[model samples]
Target: MSGCMSSSDESDVSACNHEDQGDASPMEIPADDLATSDEDEEASNPPPTKKQKTLESKKPKTPSQIKKSTVKVGGKCSSTNCSKKALQGGHCFEHGGGYKCSEEGCTKQAKVRGKCVPHSGGNRCTQPDCTKLARLKGLCIAHGGANVCSFQNCTKTVQSKGKCIDHGGGKKCSKRGCHNQVVSDKLCFEHGGGN
Candidate 1:
């Protein structure tokens, strides 16, 4: 009878110890080794960084800002070359960054648009007779390229009624002996009369 009572007492003590241990888990720690919390981590990591904020583009690094460089007044890559200025985005034709011409002597930047001038209607080249790019209509101003039509070169200027020679003024075609309605665009009947 005494042995049975002692066994009951020992079992009770063992069950109580187990229940206490189950309530308090071993892994339930509150980040004891973490010297600081999230607030401190953010404070030390920083945001956009010092130099990253100065760049102008929405994207972090623009092509012009590459190689950590700047341009000079007389045309030279101010980063380290000390020679003639390369293009701000990449290398211009003269500086030799490997881009083909839109046409002859046209050193406009070559984008997917595929011209030295990007979107100037191919007028990116500032030279007087160097209308090399066809940005708007696949051609430039000179050499019978995009007629612009707002100005007065070909009677094909078709904005208003009196605008195009063919549709309005009945001007003769500038080509040899073909006298049709010379509208803002200079194509014959078979060509898109540009009416």
Candidate 2:
């Protein structure tokens, strides 16, 4: 009985070895073929190097490097010497083209409400009950719209100021006793102010 059991166990081990060999054979054959194919592909088409890619991206595009980027609108502007694209009325925006204001006697181009800003009351003052066009700070001129001098009680309009030029707002001339305003380099126009 011991001899019979040993023979059966040997047969079982041999069967398992055969099954393993069969599975390994198929797997190994495909793996080898795939590696060879990948090597062939790499040899045929080498990828661009980092330096080559960088140089290609840095290259500037020329006028005729390709084709016109904008889609062909089939026609050009009606104005002579103008090469701009034409809108629906065969004219460009600068050439009095595009939808006009729908308001009676208003020939200006319409932005909204079928009328221009002035006629349509667009950009009105933010001040309560104020209908004037907004000039600055969402307010009209009477509502402190423009920037004024920073000096006390000074009403002069300025880019920025402690006072207006007459009251020493800007840099004065560097010449001794010169009251003229400085143009550049701390010198007045007559004193060779930096041209």
Candidate 3:
């Protein structure tokens, strides 16, 4: 018991020595080495800035602006303009609500006794008695035929003034005492028709 008491005292003396050594000041550090000052800290990492968003500029719109858009239909024209319609490859009589030449791709409309500004590939004659494609030529054979001569089957060259008679560049045809070149109301001499 006396030896145990001496060893315990020795251990307590070593613990006291350790406590005294702990009293020494901790290792000194320079003040400059510590993190301080917003600017000095920010030198390593800058603060983020707010980003601005961009937008595209556009023109303002109105009802009139929208109405200006062209439409394909609505309106009509008079008979005088009929020929003009024909030359524009012919049009329905109404002609898109009185808007002449307003067809989507056409530039010509009714003008001067069935005339329109000429365009390529669109002149077709639609005269009542004629059916030929109305082009640079004004009239077709049947209309031209009747205008030049009054008699039926008048196979005569058109004279100085579109006449068909002995005095007008062509000799009258005399087929078996017939009065006209073609069969006609002007009958043969036997029928008492020719004067």
Model 1, runs deviating above 4 Å: 1-37, 48-131, 135-139, 148-195
lDDT, candidate 1, 79-155, per-residue tens: 34434334443333344332343554554545544444544353443446564654344444453443334545553
* Candidate 3 TM-score, true structure as reference: 0.17
Write model 2 residue lDDT over 1-195, tens digit each, in one string: 334446658776555655666756423655788899999999999999999875643333222332342322324555577655544344554554445666777666565675666677667788899876777888866677777777778776654365666567777889998876775578775575633
Candidate 2 has a TM-score of 0.26
Candidate 2 weakest ten by summed lDDT: 60-69
Q: What is the lDDT of residue 15 in candidate 3?
A: 56
lDDT-best of 1 and 3: 1
lDDT of 2 at 76: 51
lDDT of 1: 0.45
The estimated TM-scores of all candidates read: 0.24, 0.26, 0.17
Q: What lDDT does model 2 reach?
A: 0.61
- The Cα local distance difference test for each model comes to 0.45, 0.61, 0.38
Residue 73 in candidate 3, Cα distance off native in Å: 52
